[model samples]
Target: MPADLCPADAALAARLPQGVLRDPAPAYLEEPRGRWLGQAGLIAAPRDTAECAAIIRACAEARVPVVPRGGGTGLVGGQVMSQGPAPLVLSLERMTAIRSIHPDEGVMIAESGVTLHAAREAAARVGRQFPLSLASQGSAQIGGVLATNAGGVNVLRYGNARALCLGIEAVLPSGEVMHDLKRLRKDNTGYDLRDLLIGAEGTLGIITAASLVLAPVPAETGVALLVVDGPEAALTLLSLAQARMAGGVTAFEMIAGQGLRFLAEAFPEMRQPFPAPPDWSVLIEVGLPDGLSAQAALEGLFAAGVEAGLASDGVIAQSGREAAELWALREHIPLANRHVGAIANHDISLPLSEIARFIADAGAMIAAEGDMRINCFGHLGDGNLHYNFFPAPGRTREDYDQYRKPMTRRIHEMVVARGGSFSAEHGVGRLKAADLAEWGDPARLAAMRAIKAALDPVGIMNPGVILA
Candidate 1:
């Protein structure tokens, strides 16, 4: 630890809400590098925007780097307090509150600390859908979701967190709250600052509360499992679903045979969504507008797909429980993957047209690396793939750790070559900061740096993320 950059002093700690800070035990230090902890530091939980703003002000005054945290579900270690003069962990978990739900206006305002699942439930109570549902919704807070601009299964129809958000209330780096909490669908503002902070990964500002746009709960939602030969057929089926179903198609997820096998072996509850496992499967959902027939829309797509040779067989969910079970198979992947072995995970995106080709080529390239199992699956509708390379069947955990950096670089380069992104839904936390510096465009990097410098002149807020 840098002697000059030690833990926060008594004065600073006293300013925080009582019992809101923790200095990790010495034994907890030097355990491992991960999302949760980073050396010994002060972790402060504030109750509201005012408390958060006050914490920021104190940190700014002390030239202390403040890492804003919401649920700490971030994969990239962005929320860890690692550096600077008494780097402080600014947690918003205590401020969780669903402020209001305006069903008529289709807006739900909630504190940043509110869990996504909580927000979704609150919206559902009024017969609306928040539409930013994700695997981590149970623990991922609204602030973290907005900070990462999280995209989930329904992004094909409802868009990502950025699109679902109408306006944000954030504390800028200079300790001033930029409150633009209006629920307006159209605002001809001189500058859309809300957008700036949405995906900034807490580097530019600290999100406090947000006004999120809600959609009326779909009158009917149909889920199905379509077995296809491969990625090409999956793409074809997606095109067919989009064309034949009109605006009803919401989610179109593709899972490879290998990924399915892994899940089946790892998770006992996850059955094969097909009678006979095919090379690939598309988990689709169609959200019918009022007076539209969801079942008819899916049945037509299935018939057309079989006729066109895009799908070999399919199963339409007969009830809500069936639909939820079918979705559970897709949503339980990350958890199931953990039981397999250590894996290098990549959240990447390419053009919809390039997906099939990229999957084919990337799979072959990765195979050449030798002795690794590839569990590749994701939201094919939006061109995002969670391409995870599992450790060799018998390799020790340490062996897998050794390949982390080099393998990640190789895969990222391959993704980049196919006009894909290295980081898709997951934002650049500490894990990707070096990669951003290495592969990111210089001009784009400059703009990000300028914004960081302008908003956080002292670099007190969530530094070493995207810009650093």
Candidate 2:
């Protein structure tokens, strides 16, 4: 109930259900990165799909923009609208419900507001797992996960959010509820609207609920950390593991010495297994069938890697606690980076063959130009690296603020030149919309614009997002 709310918006608010309207709060106005503060004429948290549709219909008639919000954990600005007329922020936090789960068919139909952690727990109850694992899963909702097509560590094996989703139910910009949440594995429909909305980042519509795929839990799992000479050796070791594991490789993450140093600097009390962090290492996980020893499998892989000169040393987790500790090191790298404060970060993905080359070239170029510290690491199995730049010792991020933009543009240019993406897992929210426009193909840009104009004639859905 903002004092400046337009008359049409006020009338629309009166027409909605009693509990749907919410008071504006700071959480709904800002994204995680604190890049911008949003303006909302109204906040609507619908408890069900019917209420969600009603709110959208009223907004449609009154021509008020609608910005769909999930868990407010998005790194991009998709959850907020900073400019234009104040919008109605449609939050899906109250719509969390797992409608049904068919373990036999490996599918779970859940409302969009269901947090990823809840879905995973629900699947675990039936001896299955939801493979899309992100550090923010505790707060990231299923709708937003699908909307952004997020990719996490397991993407090396289970694939991205788009692949795990079987179907989705979304409300189009015009307030029409598209009930396409099918459990069928194969549906050769005329046009797959489900695919469009999954990665549209709410520009086309707001996703309400979805049918997600659940994977069977592996009988045995093992984790290991191996020291590699460099990115090239890491890539070679990955190939060796894949050839031997035969689809058993669960995750293959690359870690740089710089990342470990930052962790030590940020969290002095955190236990690090290595006496001194190697220049480069990879933490790999494997899953095997019953009666197969995961530890033995990893031991064999490690021996082979060493013989082939791909890895020099390694450590295999002996128990669940040890495995969790090892994984903790890899997961904490981002937190360490945040604590150190980066001047520039690029979530770029390169062709598998071009990864090592890009890293070497980019690292060298940046090093030759300045005293910036580089921490390049991520899901090397998928060629997506979080290439970040930090100020040198005794310096702050503000000291090199001028280099953030040009450095990001340069890094993205290098990635695109190698036939990779500028925005790998994160959707092209407001942050990278300009990059998308400058680097996107002419034909693809035209098609996207046409789709936007056709689907949202009044353009009330998440304006100032993907498109320029």
Candidate 3:
């Protein structure tokens, strides 16, 4: 590394490959705020692990803040550059290459820039499945998913991104490359350092590559929509369905009647999953092993729900296309709400038993606030819910924006009081840093800060992200 890599230089005439330096004023923003402003700085697109380490080393020596960005699809401002003499953005978008896939070992290694879609496609080509499916998979890079420790709809059984990962390759703040990409199932090491980097949001280190765990592709899938009286009944149906579906229960989501209505209005072609509208409905998916049928499992679960009166109405998808269509309804609700100008959205999780109580209580509280339309629905099987509030019937976006913080604060407090987490899937990026400071346990906060300080002593990598 050289000492001339200062933040002031437009382009430092370096001895490295010309592909590493990028000279352009790219667009940057702090989302959750969605403020897009001009970001003038040099960018680096390192080709390999050594180049990545060199870039970090140069940035650290120069005392320049380095923000590791991947796909820029993160909900929080984790990828944003809001401060510091136009920080250098080290993007891994160019290092996308599937290194190898070992079906027998059930592991695959790929560079950070590889999209989730590409990774899964590679796995599929090899007759394996990378089951971490998220909405942004089309554009989201594997590095971003691993850095944020993202969880998606299928997390009911497959677990989150961290659970699906076996090994990680990251560039430490001191410019040392940690190549811990071993395919071991169990390693009783001194500490789980890979887990530390998993959800650090690029604050600790830059994840350049990862070795991920793969599952056998499901031979068959059964999809169904069950309408129940309310969230409590939804939970009952989930309990019964889980008992029968076991590992096959891939997704167990809850949709409120109002959310379904919005989806219908927004997407006219989408068929409602239920015959009659109920206050709440659950979308359950069962994936069987090779040569096994999920139909039997789904049918038995439905019968039990109907007989017990936990489910009032339901429909089992007759075909694969129908099942995909039903899932589209659930997945596209967020898009529909975005189109309707949703000013505030909370991705939260509560205890399974307390979901009903939280929904009822939160709905009443939000309703009391003048003219707010709430869209509260999501993964009921695991207690995660996307509780969104649109601007009061006819208010401007600005009006809604002003009240977002207060509304979110109250709602988050209620969620905390109910023995639930304020953030379930979406991480504590710049948006929730303050809330984290306030609500996070003091001992835990201190420990996290200690780790952050030790990892990046100069506070360079994604400063002001998850920790102070």
Candidate 4:
């Protein structure tokens, strides 16, 4: 077992300019899902990269475990160490700074603690767009975003967090700073250490700052909500939109009727675009150049979809305000889901062709187990789905707690059988370490273990994460 932070570490705490908090508050111990309540003897917020390095060095020397924390907005238990020795929680909250912005070069260097919303606004100030967006953008920090390689709605066009990051400045397990914050578009280095560390979930190293890629603001943008027949029809509509709009399709999200119903039940004030939610519908956004009209493109796609019988009805946003309102609905679905409570929540991805089949099969499999409510929705453009299970009407999640484990296992097995990932954007954290071990290829698992041993031999960096 790893050693806990004790009074002997007072000298190291004194060296940190930002100081340490001995009492781990509810904010530091609890995760968003409330699945894990962590225990920590010390909570240190470093003001700078050097201070972060010193704290890590002290932990390494003392052979004490250190859990790197960000905004604590992670759905998984990555930010919290649940069942381990009381460790030092190193938070990057104090290091929130925009180091530099190069609008001409389309890049920005920001400290890890900078929230995604701040980064987006910074890019907007320079007339550039950071493109990466999520429901948690208001609280999710750059470090945690890149660490888990998050994928959100815009991932259909902008790619994940790993793609947005060009380089990172990180502190290794031994307290050595790996300063490779280059804005270069092309770097032919021996090994891509930046890529390795980005999705490592702080198990390899803790990212302090990053150089991120930005995009030119779209000249025209529009959002459309289209009613589809089912997952198959949604897929057809996606292909049609891609064929018609090409690179203009910025986001293609699918929402099941149950999700819309839940939104209505939980948040009655929020306007529903459709009078009655279709069994399956899609929210598509298009970003076009100056000459091309996004509204026209969406109308064209809608007309084609209707003619092809892929879509039954649709509505397009008439203004920027309308577009944001439409996005607000999409973003608030998760909140509605939380209010309803979930028995099992899954974030999985499948090959584009297998999505419809997997959804159909998984629904059937879950139905066989029990009469549960399933909300199947997500970024259909990129083949990632939030396949969540909830209690039946007039029921509570606790009433079905006994089935959570078996239902999750069934879902994961079906996903893996269909060549889908058990954990899509959510990192392995403490929750999915066993799933990773079971589904991960033996060769890849071995290589990951070796890399962890090489970079964090003492396992001081976020212990019990990614690896067992």
Candidate 5:
């Protein structure tokens, strides 16, 4: 704990509105990974932007750390400040109002507390689609989604959280509310604060509400699971699909055979497409125009892939139920990973050209270190892969604790060398702070530090996060 830092005092409590304060419960202190346990001086759930600003003002005046929390589904330690002076954990649970929905204009203004799932439902109710989809959409809030700039399955077609968001309303570090949630698609304004805070991970400010962009639902959509020879074949097939589809590919995800086996081991009853999982496969989804047939498009893609020796066997979804079933298998992968504990989990991204080499080389490198299982899979179209390491059968993750740091360093080193990011999709929370310090470019690091110092002069916002 810092010497000058203080927890919320009696004065701080009096500053907040009645019913805003709550007990610092265990759920507020824990993250999804169970890697670190946080300590909270207090927990506050403000109902609106004014109350949120008041909470921040009180914390700022008290020189207390303010850790903004949303769904707590974040993999990294951003939501929880494990070691520090106990912070006022600001929860965005009460600000659930969808202020306005402009479906005709293809936009919606929503408070930060609205869950991604709820936002999606609201968009659907108006005959539109909010394209940002995540496995934890039901729990993940819009604030946290933009806070971390989350990337999900549909990033190939629609883009990430940052791209989907048109503007944001946030409470800056000084307790002033930034009410710039404009629904404009084009704004060449000076110093876009919305972008500044979108991926800031609560380091600069707390995002309170946002102007979310909506897209028309695709007229025709189809899904197929294609068996590829390897990552190389998968990349080639992706190129061919793009050339043919002309921006119709909604999501192109690559699944490792090992991931399938892990699913089978963890979920024995779950129905999978293939009789036996191949070494490598891809789950390609296409969304076509009204006149185009999604089934015919996928069928043609499959045939082309087979003729090019990129795919050997596959399964194309016939109905929406079948499509959901196919997607269920992909969505359950993370749950299955948690079922079988992992030694080291990496959410990395690489150049499309380098993914194959990195996968093969990194797999061999990790194998040489110790006995471990690898379940590598993710949004291949976006070059992000959840390359996770697990214990060999009959062993526990505890057995490989010694190799965790060294093996992780090796993997990250290879990724950095190949023009890739060690922390991709998942923000650089407390987990990757050291990596950012060590591997970050000197000039960029200096600018980040300068920005942090200027915006959060008191260092009360998410201390020891990206800067440390």
Candidate 6:
């Protein structure tokens, strides 16, 4: 077990500009899902990279475990330390800064503490778009987003967080600064360490700042909600949309009727677009160049989908306000899910060819387990789905607690059998470490262990994460 934070560490904390809090508040101890309540010996929020390095150095010398926290919006409990010796929870909440923005070069350097929404607004000020978006954008910080290598609605066009980031400045486990924040698109100098830290869940090091790529705002943007028969038809519609619009398809999300129902039950004030929700529908967005009209492109795609028998009914946004309403429905699905409660939630990805089959087989498999409700939706353009199981109308999740593990295992088994990943966008953290051990490649696991040992010899950076 690692040594606990003692009185001596207090002196070390005082050296930092933001200082430290001995008594951690509820925010530091709790996760979004309320799955795990963490324990911390000390809470240190550093203002800059140097103070962060100093805190890490002190923890390294004392062999004290350090848990790097961002905005605490992680679903996988990566930001929480629940077991082992008490840890010093290092937060980057105070490091919020937009260091620079070069609109001509299409690059922006931002401190890790800046929220995703803030970053987006910063980019918008210069007529550029930071395309990495998520439901938790208002609170999810850059450090956490890059740590987990987040993938959101715009991934179909903009790619994941890793692809959006050009370079990063992180503090190593050994307290050394890796100042590799460059605005270049190509660099093959040596090993790509920036990628190694991103998606490492702060187990490797703390990402302090990043140089991110920006894109010009779309000349013409359009959103449409189309009713599909099922996942199979949705896949077919995706193909048709992509073929018709070419690279203009920016976001394609599949939503089940259950999600719409959940929203009605959870938030009655939120307006529903359709009078009666279809069994299965897709939210599609297309961004066209100056000469092309997004509305015309979507109408063409919709007509093709109708002729192909992939779509039954659809509605294309007529104005910007209507587009915002369309996206609000998609973005609020998670909130609805949380309000209703889930027995088990899965963020998984599969090969496009196998997604339809997996969804059908998995649903049948889960139905046999119990009479549960499933809200299946997500970024169909990229093959990632949020498959969550909820209790029956009159039941609660606590009543089904005994079956959570078995249900999760069964779903994961089906996913793996169908050439899918159990953890897609969400990193392993402590929640999926055992899943990684069970499903991860043996050689790859061994290599990861070696890399962790090399970078964090003392095991001070986020113990009990990724590798079990």
lDDT at 91, model 6: 89
Question: What overall lDDT, based on C-alpha atoms, would model 5 receive against the true structure?
Answer: 0.92
lDDT, candidate 6, 357-402, per-residue tens? 9888988988888889999999999999999999999999999999
- Please provide, for model 5 over 141-177, each residue's C-alpha lDDT reduced to its tens digit, 9 standing for 90 to 100: 9999999999999999999899999999999999999
Model 2 per-residue lDDT tens digits across residues 188-293 = 9789999999889999988999999999999999999999999999999999999998999999999999999999999889888889989999999999899999
Writing each residue's lDDT as its tens digit, candidate 3 over 253-369 gives 898877887777688787775654567888888888876678877778888988998976778889999899888888898878876777688989998888888889988997887
lDDT of each: 0.82, 0.92, 0.83, 0.90, 0.92, 0.92
The ten-residue window of minimal lDDT in model 1 covers 26-35
Clashes of 5: 0
Show how many residue pairs clash in every candidate, following the order shown. 0, 0, 0, 0, 0, 0
Higher-TM-score candidate among 2 and 6?
Answer: 2
Where model 3 places Cα greater than 4 Å from the true spot, the runs are 1-7, 11-17, 23-33, 36-40, 273-277
Candidate 4 lowest-lDDT run of ten: 1-10
Error of 3 at 443 (Å): 0.9
Give the Cα error of residue 175 in candidate 3, in Å: 0.8
Off by over 4 Å in 4: 1-6, 9-23
Q: Model 6, residue 129: what's the lDDT?
A: 97
TM-score, every prediction? 0.94, 0.98, 0.94, 0.97, 0.98, 0.97
Worst 10 residues of 6 by lDDT: 14-23
Model 5 segments more than 4 A misplaced: 1-8
lDDT value, residue 214 of candidate 1: 90
lDDT of 1: 0.82
